[model samples]
Target: MSVRDFAHFIAIDWSGARGARHKAIAMAVADAAGGPPVLVRRQRGWSRAEILEVLTDGLPANSLVGLDLGIALPFADRGAYFPDWDQSPPDARALWSLVDEMCAEDDHLCAGGFVDHPQASAYFRRHGAREGARFAPEGQTGGRGRFRVTERAQEAIGCKPYSNFNLVGAAQVGKSSLTGMRVLHRLGGRVPVWPIDPLPGEGSVVVEIYTTIAAIAAGRTASRSKMRDFAELNAALANLGSPPVAGDGAIDDHASDALLTAAWLRVAAHDPAMWLPAGLTPEIARTEGWTFGVA
Candidate 1:
């Protein structure tokens, strides 16, 4: 496939926490031509639907959208996303379909339905002391649960990642991942998702990204990746060779995440090595999916 010279790079710091309009859902954009990343702001904050609208109708052609979420669950480690379950989907696309179908009634694209599903709940670590039987770390009493191969690679690169099966705790991402799958399914090929869909000759494409990778590339430690003000953020932007945005004082960490990652994407997207990681076999790409920067 020919390499695409994407015209824009967008980063979305997504949220899974309950709410109609999430303060944590932040969006930012960087023009590939040059300059600092800018936040895509709204007076009342962003809703999941609004992000979907931008993806479907508002985005410029040849944009590279980086969504900060796990696109799929751990499959290679367990041989199935839901082992011993009848409805376990065979691949990421089907998995997205399953999540969307199950979560159809979940307003705001929330994943509460899938988390509480009779069979599906058994595979997840949920809140209120509801750790499913399979939630135990395999061959161990307790620890982080199963991880996709790409996640293991992420750890290898010094980025701490959490199991997407985990629904409780502040660091867990199961809710967000499941919610993102619904959006991917709804995307319906309007914009291709990398790995899941091969890159086209010319056009926009979406890729799953772990924002922590961008933070690490900007010389920030994973533990201190969250930036709360313009001063701290501009430092990281400088590290990525991006000009500073105009701002100061307290800012949402989610906003900082989106802005910094947008700038990071603009620089990182051009690297040929970033697209092909050793861990991303065709099977793994179809099932577990790779984070864009893990290599």
Candidate 2:
């Protein structure tokens, strides 16, 4: 089916926790012609089977899905960086090398690095990594052919993971919030994932904040320069908190703060001059270019 024929898009923010405090997958859907996105469902503490079922049910044929978790690409052969979780785990160096190679080869693939290093481990502590760091044999990384996945790859697989691709400035300020918005915007308005707080009854104000930003970003209701719009919106919706709305109470400044940070990232990704709050290096700013300004 043609890209235009694809009717809906879904973004899944995954979590491994089990309880009321656990996050549910946040979902947003938009029509092919481009319109406002609607929040369809938010389920807290879903199981793998539930997630899979949601994936299968929500994603119609020809529709695209952008997931927060990694999907493993089946190797044509095996490589040096493959994680040996069953025996010896791969080191940081090996994992980095593999990521560097993969990223250099494919623009669509993201290199999050190997999961063995202290730094890498910290970065991906929540999201699980793939097993077997050993590289597949020559031509295994899909050098010339299409990447393949085994039919039995039902388990959470780790492949060339994709980053949020938000503007760099946003990434620096509120990485999670901005990245989530960027992914949602790119998917044409699909909420990236569900949000839940650490405490069982704490509630999910943060999720609402992110989803609101995603909706606004996708809807073009606010621009990169007008972050205050999001702030004001959040302030207005502070009460009536829920999966898609902030609880009723005093306005939460945190939402505005995060959205502003993300807005700066979006601005910087498009025009470096818009970057503010300082401290963002030229190198980091340059990397931000890859994620900004795609409709």
Candidate 3:
């Protein structure tokens, strides 16, 4: 579809922590007609399955859905997602299938099984001091672990991105990205994932996003991106030229994140450059997907 054709912009602040329902999962949508983005709050919190179902059929036609997670593992640096594994999948599609199949029994779409797999576990840094032998295969000491080409592009634009291979810290996205892969695999092409799946002419599509990028676009430094109260959120919204969301006092970062990103997508989606980043090769798009706002 044309960049401006998306009828609605949706942003999901996702979580990969183990649980049947996750309070950290937040969703917001900004309409093409203009207004403050609205959050899709759930009383019992959101389940990965429920979110999948929403992507399957619950969305309005021609909506642009943004999921906050790394869509694929590092490939360009090693010429393979799992450089040491003979059976490592060739591209993002196969990698998603592999993750889904391996983590089939993992409840709430968790990726515990894959991370703990004898071979797969060797590539990831899991909890409990279980640092995989190959977590830093290239012997690149200190700093962070490996990163996808898209992530490198994200870093180029003033965003501090963690390696999808590192699952240790509070900011780590490895687990969440893996869990998201499971859901993407199950979607079965019902909703197209951009870059990996070419943008369609007239339908909804999914894309990876980093909320910090949106926050930066709203005039906050990446280090000071998280807004904890209504005052801060409204100030950021003003920077984006969006109307204030009614509220006061404290607010969950998850909700504010989703809201601002939804608004950002509304504006960012109109730019053709976002869909065609200089670093995005066909090889990279198929193997390591690109983030929507990175360009």
Candidate 4:
């Protein structure tokens, strides 16, 4: 859909620090129609609660808010490196096995098994403690142990009892790959989630969000090639106006712009002539073969 069709477009740059400095930079681009993207809001040092409040309050119900954080799978490494290896913890293993069995019964979800090890099982059980168990150690109190075990048993063959907002991408560098995998898993193997390479000298989170939006707008899945093409498209678009940068050696601002370009590209693809500028069309750009749909 075109920008005009969307109620609002949101971009969030997350940060984990104390006070406002730790808050994320959020930008909302409204559908001005035939005009440049309007920066309706730009806030800094926004806490998680503030961000969520603003997001829920400002945007329309149907508006799509593209966040730089991983909103499905919170932990990196798929919780694999939670000080427990080889085997899944008892609670985790049991819960996972149930999930697998349920998936087996349903054709929609994929099936998988956990590592078969006693220590690993114990660790998994301890790690995925229930509400009451969270405060008490795994086996500390009978109430905590029974409650956690019962909860694990209750969800043995389906999704775990958790919320999506808890799943944010890796806060530190050098963990994108692992973080991406966990994010995918948290998405329930359905929606398309792209894992992008980190931007040089800048936080990778922004780049990841940009790439994902671009790919979605293009009606395509992402890859290295598409990302490069997006960069080129951003440069081309920027060239159309007063340059956002002076020389070729400038900080890449393509991340957010690329997402806009991709959104426009989707608009163009639906009605090629409408979104294309004079003498600048998708065909001329040779992006016809660039499919954005998931495999």
TM-score of each: 0.97, 0.32, 0.98, 0.34
lDDT (0 to 1) per candidate? 0.89, 0.29, 0.92, 0.30
Looking at model 1, report the run of 10 residues with the lowest lDDT sum. Answer: 135-144
Q: Which parts of model 4 have CA positions greater than 4 angstroms off?
A: 1-5, 22-24, 30-34, 43-45, 74-295
lDDT tens readout by residue for model 4, 57-87:
4444334344443222112223322233333
Question: What is the overall TM-score of model 1 with all chains considered together?
Answer: 0.97
lDDT of 3 by residue, 242-291 (tens): 99999999999999999999999999998988988899999999999999
Return the top candidate by lDDT: 3
lDDT of 2 by residue, 98-215 (tens): 4444334322222322233433332222223232213223334312222222211211221121222111232211123222322222332232222111111221111112222333
lDDT of 1: 0.89
Q: Which scores better on lDDT, 2 or 3?
A: 3
Expressed as tens digits, the lDDT of each residue in 40-90 for candidate 1 is 888899988888888888898899999999999999987899888989999
Q: CA lDDT of 182 in candidate 4?
A: 32
Please say which candidate is ahead in lDDT: 2 or 4: 4
Off by over 4 Å in 1: none
| Model 3: residue 40 alpha-carbon error in angstroms | 0.8
lDDT of 4 at 85: 38
Clashing pairs in model 1, backbone N/Cα/C closer than 3 A: none
Model 3 stretches astray by more than 4 angstroms? 141-143
